[model samples]
Target chain A: MNIKEYIDTANKKALERMASVQPILIDIELEAKNIIPGMDNKTILHAGPPIEWERMCGPTQGAIAGILVYEGLAADLTEGYEIAASGEIKFDCNHDHDTVGPMTGITSPHQPVFVLEDELTGKKAYCTLNEGRGRVLRFGGWNKEVLDRLNWMKSVLAPTLKKAIKHSDGINIKTIIAESLHMGDEGHNRNRSGSYLFLSELTPHMLDTTNNEIAKEVFLFIKKNADIFHLNLSMPHSKLIADAARDIDYCSLVVAMARNGTDIGIQVSSLGREWFTSPASIVEGLYFPGYSEKDACPDLGDSTISEVIGIGGFAMAASPAIVSFVGGSAREATLRTRRMYEISAGTSSIFTIPSLDFKGTPVGIDIRKVVELDETPLINTGIAHKEAGIGQIGAGLTAAPYDMFKDALKAFGAKYL
Target chain B: MKSNMNDLLSEGPKVINIGLRSFYEASETQGIKVVHIDWKPPAQGDIETIKLLDRLL
Candidate 1:
């Protein structure tokens, strides 16, 4: 087959797989060595593709130190630093272990993870719980307060959520995502609606499973942190969808987009696990009161999974409220979604936007279309501080570099057509 | 406006391009037929008239 014929056949198969996926939240489980295969005391799973400790960005290193402190392997920050540098702990990519996370994306051995399974394909994916917002370990905050928060999440929150999830017989994540889009959420930076939808489904179960006191506290915590509460659930949902559509021969669909503070990398379906990387670009948008562009780190997180599955930046038209943070107007949001359709293989059958006349969100990012149009995928991301321990500075928008797509196209041409 | 996307997409739809020829060129590359509308400011760059028209509209 010629190039176009090959791409047409591959894209048809990719779109079929993408459309067939049904990501359902199956259970909440403790992340023990037995649960996650190959997980052990020394294993530390960080986000994005693999990188050595010496080359790890500030936030990732800070998160590692924080994890050590949380696990009681280190007495203090200084000790934590020593332990990390001494190579006592192993660091690997979360993707390699069937897991995903938000910023910094650290998944220690004992952390609790949500188990998401695809009902159609029976493939599963996992993600750590969201640590709520500021001064959390995900952004590399390693203070006593951060460690205490993790302890509470691991002890109090995880067990409570586990009980609730059991009582609810596994909340349908796909339903929450679809409803959230209609109620004004793109399921990435702006998850207010998604969070509310999740609480609505989870609250009744929590009420039935737990006592009033603990239930009230859990409810209040989720209610207060509505913006990021849905992120943990959304990440694994995206991962399951991507996993279902992945590994098709000659398929140029991008299955993953991720960043460690130093580099942004993407994996294409046809190329299997090979990553095309470029230096992470600085984000441009509004910042917090005491921070500026100089304080912001490059884009970081596995949250880009949401974008790959076509809801985050690709469904911006559904969430106009995101503009206040991501530095664009409502018109621009709609335009961005419209433009994405040009480069995508097809529209999603599940997630639909009300503002777009109930049109399905664009899905299946075709690398051939990207290079042909010279348009890169836009990522809606949270900005972490350049230094560890500073937490989130702001949230904004940035595009994957054009060079990454160009390089992927060249590789695809050489390997396939 | 409730768009009948099916109608628009029935025969590999025609695009009504405005403001940029590059958009038309890009669409053409994807086998999308284009009909360019040569859009220009109504009052030929008259600031006062444009401001008045904005309020009137």
Candidate 2:
């Protein structure tokens, strides 16, 4: 077949695989090593592509140090730094282990992980529970309070969720994602509606399975921080969906977009696991009080998995409230979603935006379209402090550096049609 | 709602371009067709007016 015919066939196969994905929240479990194979005491999985400890940026290094302290491998921040620099710890990408995490995307051996299984493909992906906002380890916060919360999640929250999830066969995440989109959640940076919907589904099971006090506290924690409770669930859900489209020869679909504070990376589906990386761009958007651009680190997170699967920034039209956080008007949010459609290979078979007349959100980021149009994928992300321990300074939007897509396209042409 | 790939592949998928000519041009580049709708916000980008119109509509 010629190049045109070859590309057409590849696109068809990629889109079919994408449409077949059905991600279900199957269970919550303790010990990341148990669910995520190859995870060990010496292994540390982080977001984005692999980088040496010496090359890691402030926030990522900060998070690594925090994980070391939290895991009891190191006594404190100073000791943690020494341990990281000593090269005794093994660092790898989360994607390599069928796991995903938001922000710094640190997955230690001992943390509790939510497991998502694609019903159509029976592929499983894992992500740790959301630590909520400030001083969280994902954003490089390694303080005592951060360690305490991680411990609490392992001891209390994880067990509670495990019991609640076990009571049901599995939670159909696609249904909640669709319903939440209508109720004003883009299923990424803004998950207020999605969080509420998730709690509503699980609260009944929690009530039946757990003691009153425990159930009440879990419900309150979910309710109080309704904005991001669904992030962990969404990350793994996106991972399962995106993974379905991987390894299709000659297809130009973007399967992953992630960033460490130091570098941003993209992996094209047909390229297998090869990453095209560029310098992580500093985000341009609103900042939190007492914080400014000077204090913000470059865009960081594996949360762009949401965008890869066609929600988050790509579904911004569905959540106008996100504009307040990302620094844009409601109309601009709608336009952002529309603009994504221009470069996408197809619309999502699941996630749809209500405001766009219930149209399916754009899906399948085509590198060919991106390079041809000179448009890059837009990612909505949390800004980490340039200093690791300061945690999230703000949330904002940033474009995937055009060079990543250009590089991927170049590699695609060289490897295949 | 699930969108079928066939619909996108079929000829004459009408696009209503709102503001940017670049979007219309981009669609043309992809072998898709477009009809540029020469449109602007009512009341010329006035926030209060737009809010009032939103309520009135």
Candidate 3:
């Protein structure tokens, strides 16, 4: 296969297909196994590349143990840990099943997930709902309280949102994301404005779908948590968009970039489902009071899916307020987005930055350009405590290690050159 | 014969700094005009990797 014969047009098609897809929040599913292809009762899907239970990081192990207990496979987290260690639980990558998760990115078959779809291509992707900050499962928090929150989400929140979404004939996430860019949400780590926009779409329908008390309770559950309620929705929205561009012959743009706590992985458009990985990098940023760098885990999560299609960190110029949360100056945040264009193959005509004279956000991370340029994707993310149950300690900045891109380029060469 | 450096330095040393950012920062602190290029050793300064990259790029 001569890459020169096909690469340029192939990449252009990949970029076009990626940017053109409109991910709409079409449904809320009760079970991950029902919507996610290949997920099973005993299988626990995780973020980033596949790994055995022995090599799994602390946060991931904690999250998995909690989910096992939630699935009723174990009596408690302590027992859940032993079952997880015994290898009785099968593990799979979330990307393989068309799903993404945040932080430790644990997805049990019974957990609630948002299903986003592109009407034109009928492509769909799924992501589990976000449990609001502090002692949440995504950060490896598991106990009676944590299980109670998960249970409440399943019993009340999921059904309410499903009814509201169906009542509204599906919320247009593409529209909310476009508008939110102007209001300062990169659609990843900073989603305060997007949450309000998401609520604007859902609130009226939420009122119509449920009784007054339930509506108010669910409404405040989202309304009070301004930063994260929209994030789970954003992840699946980006996943749906990125899935459309995967497996295009000779296209070298990255389709997914996620960290499994132990390793950070990237899947290229031309490389099919094979992942190029590097040891997960330590995040650099401010820690919460009483906590320091020592408490933070390595970069972990499936949230980078938003960056894969260009909103998250790639659209940093549109969300300067993120500097305070992600720990950087406003200028640095803007520069990060400008720098991304150097490695990206294209820009999204829809997700434009107001600060940059309405210029489109850089999209399409090309693996060849990444190797040549030696610059990697800049990510803004939450930092989890290395110990399970400690939850999030801070939020910060990280980069995909360059070696992964080099390895991917060599693989591309071996196959195409 | 005239050198570009001579003319450049004659006007109080405007600088085009590459790789190391401290040099550009020092120049800027002195009110000198400076541009910093964020340069790095491509392919990690490995000749074999560069050779491979050359084939594909």
Candidate 4:
């Protein structure tokens, strides 16, 4: 067989491996460092590809400072910022640590993380618990309110969830995501449906595991924060499937695409951990009353991982309601999904869209198709305020840079040909 | 003579707007049927990148 045959077979094998993954929410860990590979007491895991403190964006730096205080390493938020800049802290990519995080993706040891295991392979992925809406740490808001919320999660929320998930045995994340798409969640910027489904699934178990008072508190917390509460679960579930598809010889399928506020990066299946990066793009969408485009950060967060497996932006056709939040017409939403099929290597058998006549969501972003057709992967993401201390101002859509895909394709030629 | 203008009046001129959604949207507001296609020059208009992409399987 020729090179085309070899590549075709390898891509098929990679997609099959990805499809075999069954991500189950196994348990919640009180301390992430105990489980996340290479994570230590002083290490702060961030999103996207790797970068150090000096080059870190405002939100990322702000998050690191707040996490330092939250971890008790610093006397106060000021000292936390000082220590972060002091080079005493080691910042690494969450993706490199077998974990994933939301905007700024600042995760420390003490923060509670949900543990997900790919039942097919026993491979696990972790993500810090989501901190609901505005004035939260993920969007760079760090203060008494933010740290207080973190403390509540670590002391109250995490332990309660730990018990409830244990009592339920395990909840299948793929099932929730598959159902969420049908109910108007693309599993990235909009996860209200997924959050509702997750809470409903775990509520009964919480009653059995914890006292009624504690169960009621946890239930109310999730209920009010349903806006993006399920995003943490979706991130790791995407990572698990992407991890399962990694490192196939001659496979040009993209396994991961993430942003660290400063730069956006992607890793193709055969490229292993090598990152092809470019400056992150500015998101174009509506903003809340006071904020404007100038106030928003360049595309931030590892949440784009949702688009890695063809949900999020790729399945926009499934969620017309998103147009109101992300700034586009309902027709444009269906067009987005229709266009993704041209670039994807295969359609997901598990996640299907109802509006599109139950067609599988486009899966497996093939880099060759992207560069050849000049179409890049787009993700629906939340907008972070460029300045620290301000949380999410809005939600919107953004596309990955084409230069990264071109560079990845060039590297693929040098490596295989 | 049966003119071309007569033909356009009976069968409206179909508009296929390429590369800009704004243009198609403007036409739609006027109650004209139009289709929008998002397009761009392939490979960033870089000939070398385009050629390299083709060479790889």
What local distance difference test score does each model get? 0.84, 0.85, 0.89, 0.90
Runs off by more than 4 Å, candidate 2: B1-57
C-alpha TM-scores of all predictions: 0.87, 0.87, 0.95, 0.95
The candidate that wins on lDDT is 4
lDDT of 4 by residue, A34-75 (tens): 999998898999999999898988998888888888888988
Model 3, C-alpha of A196: deviation from truth (Å): 1.0
lDDT of 1 by residue, A1-417 (tens): 665666678878988887677788877777645466678998888888788899989999999988888877888887888899998898888877788999999988888899888887778888888888878899987777888888888898889989999887778788898889988889998888888988888889989999999999988888889988899999999988887767888787999988988888899998888889999989988899999999988889888999898999999999998999788899999989988897798998898988889999999888766765556898888999999998998888998887787678778766753
User: Which residue segments of model 4 deviate by more than 4 Å?
Assistant: B1-39
Tens digits of lDDT, candidate 3, A330-416: 999999999999989888989999999999999999887788778899999999989888888999999889998988888888888
Judged by DockQ cut-offs, the docking class of candidate 1 is incorrect
- Cα lDDT for residue A297, candidate 2: 85
What 10-residue stretch in candidate 4 chain A is worst by lDDT? A1-10
Candidate 3 residues lying further than 4 Å off, grouped into runs, are: B1-13, B26-33
Clashing pairs in 4: none
- Classify candidate 4 by CAPRI docking class: medium
Which lDDT value does model 4 have at A191? Answer: 91
| Interface CA RMSD of each prediction in angstroms | 19.9, 19.1, 1.6, 1.8
